[model samples]
Target: MSGRFQAAAPKAPSTLEKITKSPLFTVGLNTAYFVAGIAFIQSPLMEMLVPQL
Candidate 1:
């Protein structure tokens, strides 16, 4: 490929890469996920899905 027409190498993190490694992003994300998990366990869905729950 000619220099002018060649694709440029990736110089920065893509959207998914940025999100996966972000500290502030994960802090809230992890907290919310944990909270949601707790709520899910206490919800009727848990009993219906896992009869032993």
Candidate 2:
């Protein structure tokens, strides 16, 4: 019971794997960061253009 309660380790790719897939890796990483920052980071230009409600 106690042993089974432990959490699983996080699985992720190695640095080489990310570098080998450079274009996709960087684009995906940047896109994810940008989207996550949208709500926190304000941009007057963008707000003016789109007119936030």
Q: List ranges where model 2 is wrong by over 4 Å.
A: 1-21, 41-53
lDDT of 1 by residue, 1-53 (tens): 45577678979989998988999888999899999999999999898897563
Q: Cα lDDT of all candidates, in order?
A: 0.89, 0.78
- Per candidate, the number of residue pairs that clash is 0, 0
Deviation in angstroms for 35 in model 2? 0.6
Q: Pick the candidate with the highest lDDT.
A: 1
Report model 1's TM-score to 2 decimal places: 0.51
Report the Cα lDDT for residue 16, model 2.
94
Where does model 1 exceed 4 Å of error?
1-22
**Model 2 Cα lDDT, one tens digit per residue, 18-39:** 6968898888889889987895
Query: Which ten residues in a row are the worst by lDDT in model 2?
Result: 39-48
Indicate the residue-level lDDT of 47 in model 2: 67
